[model samples]
Target: MIEARQLTKRYGDKVAVDGVDFTVRPGAVTGFLGPNGAGKSTTMRMIIGLDAPTAGTVTVNGRRYAQHSAPLREVGALLEARSIHPGRSAFDHLMALAYTHGISRARVSEVIEMTGLQSVARKRAGAFSLGMGQRLGIAAAVLGDPQTVMLDEPVNGLDPEGVLWIRNLLTGLAAEGRTVFVSSHLMSEMALVADHLIIVGRGRVLADTTVRDLVLQAGGDTVVVATDDPAELRRVLVGPGVEITGHPGSEQLTVTGLPAREIGRKAAEHGLVLFELTAKTVSLEEAFMELTKESVEYHAASTTGRAA
Candidate 1:
């Protein structure tokens, strides 16, 4: 398991990571998510001892990452996929890492095959493509058979097949009771694979909850109403704690602060002709956008042409 308490990091006068706290338990996959410049990478770096925390503590399997006698055996991480020496072959690189930790040549071969790098095992590391580099990084990560696995953007350069493979690999690791923590900007993939989430915004913990709960919480009151007469329906539904949105002449209305059944009842009582009424369940992407809208570091301007 991975745990952090009041973990903080600062660079000069800027705070990179705030007093963050979250736990990644074994037998589950936890996704780390945030917008650009939200301190996600910085937080991950501190977890693996890449950077020192200004305050608080973080532990991997009950101890700091550097304190472990065989760090690889305790935690396997793919922080940077391209952090290998250019002069070394894939096999040579794995062998070097194995030698330091007393890992065997057989294990090295096994990982090479596991990551589907057998054909290019003897190829120079610098010549490999981004997808191949990702595979090599993963092979090195699991080479020690560690109890915890952490990866940052493992699918950055992967194709469709590779992305699918990673999804299965993450779930498989967690199935074996390993603590699997991954950081990704892909919300759709995270929604499918992650059992829980640790979301950050501007270096602070914005949410720490399960996938289902987050979506439900964000979508609880949202309802879609289709009616023949939207104007009259809107007038009837307008009240305290209610929000309605739609084009003036549109037949559909997006309503919040009211339940679907309540709207149906009110419509029926008013004898309004209704076409459809749906309690909209917000998707993972929608929930994420709503939660992080205010925390987004950059905003793109409208593409609509302005008057010259």
Candidate 2:
């Protein structure tokens, strides 16, 4: 397990990471997410002892990373794929890492095959494609057979097949009772892969909970009813328990706290004819966008921005 207690970091006048507390448990895929410049990389660097925190603390398996006797065996991370030596062959790179830990050549081969890099094992890392580089990075992270793995943007340059491979790989690692903490900006991918999520924005945690809980908390199962008489529908839906909102200029009512069937039955009992009555559960991407919009640092052209 990885735990952070009020973890904070600052560089000069700018605070890269604020006091944040979260945990990544074993046997689950926990997603770490944030917008650009939201301090995800900084936090990962601090966890791995690459960067020092100005305040608070973080520990891996109950000890600081530096305090661990066999840190590589306890935690493995792939922070950046390009951090490897470009001129070295993939096999040579893993061999060097194995040498430092007194690991066997057989183990290096095992990881090479496991990451699907056998064909390119002898190729220089500089000549490998981005997807191959990412695979090589994963091989390095798993080379120690660590109990905890942290991968930042593991699927950045992957194709569809490569993406599926990584999703299965991370899930398999977690299934083996290993802690898998992955960070990605793709909400759809995270939604499909992560069992739990730690959403950070502006250097602080906005949420730390299961995907289901986050979606529920962001509101779900909204019933949209299109009717010519929206005012009557509003009057019927208006009460202490139900929420009714006018949907733009259309003669539609967005109802919450009521199931679609219940709304349909209510409308039918009231002798109301509806053009459309649809139950809409908010998608993870939509929920994530709603949660992180205010936290986003970079806003591109409004005219070109993709609609949610």
lDDT of 1 by residue, 16-46 (tens): 8999999999999999999999999998899
Task: Show pairs that collide, candidate 2.
Answer: none
User: Could you tell me the TM-score of candidate 2?
Assistant: 0.87
Return the TM-score for candidate 1, rounded to 2 decimals: 0.84
**What RMSD does each model have against the real structure?**
4.4, 3.7
Candidate 1 C-alpha error for residue 163, in Å? 0.4
Task: For each candidate, give its TM-score against the true structure.
Answer: 0.84, 0.87
Q: After superposition, how far is residue 299 of candidate 2 from its true place, in Å?
A: 2.4
Per-residue lDDT of candidate 2, residues 109-206 (tens digit):
99999989999999999999999999999999999999999999999889999999999999999999999999998888998999999988999999
Kindly report which residue stretches of model 2 are placed more than 4 angstroms away from their true locations once superposed. Answer: 226-252, 259-274, 303-308
